[model samples]
Target: MLLEIDAQSQTPIYQQICNQLIIGIATNKLQPGEILPSVRQMADEIGVNMMTVSKAYTLLKNDGYILTDRRNGTMVAAKQSLDPPFQARFSRELELLLAEASIHQISETMIQEKIKQIYQKFE
Candidate 1:
């Protein structure tokens, strides 16, 4: 897996890692049961603090994107569907995004088309 981090960006390194990994899972670049690099290994590979990678992995774990066990270390999780809390969180985030787009004067049609394009990526 490849992760690109921009030191100058507004987003934190941990969040950048989380975003990319989530994208990878959604796009099937990372598959269920596939092993992920350990926090130390990922830190060494990407030249970041181990804690940062650990935080990203922790967030993914909390969000149900990954699994951890003594035998497996860390791996992608096979989520059958979104649970209630997750669905609510996603709805709120999407609502905020749409609000921000409207604030920027992005048209409804454009927002919908962009949404469609993103949905297609998951498919």
Candidate 2:
């Protein structure tokens, strides 16, 4: 997976790495059980500190997006079905977004179109 880092962005480098990896998984760019680059290698490639890459990997592992093993290294985990609490949180976030769009006078069609555009990025 090709991860692009924006050093100047407000988001931290580790978070950017995690976000991109998540997108890669969502878009099928990174297949389940595929091995990711080693932390040292990824850090060298991305021009970031090893600790930054390690932090990203740790976050992914903690979130169950990736798994690390001594023999196998790191690989993407199978996608898990969202449970009730997660579904509720997703719904709440979506409602907030829709509410903000409505306050801005964005039409339903326009909002849907925007969502489609964002979703297409994952594909």
Which model scores highest in TM-score? 1
Clashing pairs in 2: none
TM-score attained by model 1: 0.95
Taking the tens digit of each residue's C-alpha lDDT, what string does model 2 give over 8-58?
A: 999999999999999899988999999999999999999999999999999
TM-score between model 2 and native: 0.85
The local lDDT score (0 to 100) that residue 84 gets in candidate 1 is 93
The runs of at least 3 residues in candidate 1 whose Cα sits more than 4 Å from the true structure, single-residue gaps closed, are none
What's the CA error at residue 74 for candidate 2, in Å?
0.5
The models' CA-based lDDT, in order, is 0.93, 0.93
Error of 1 at 120 (Å): 0.6
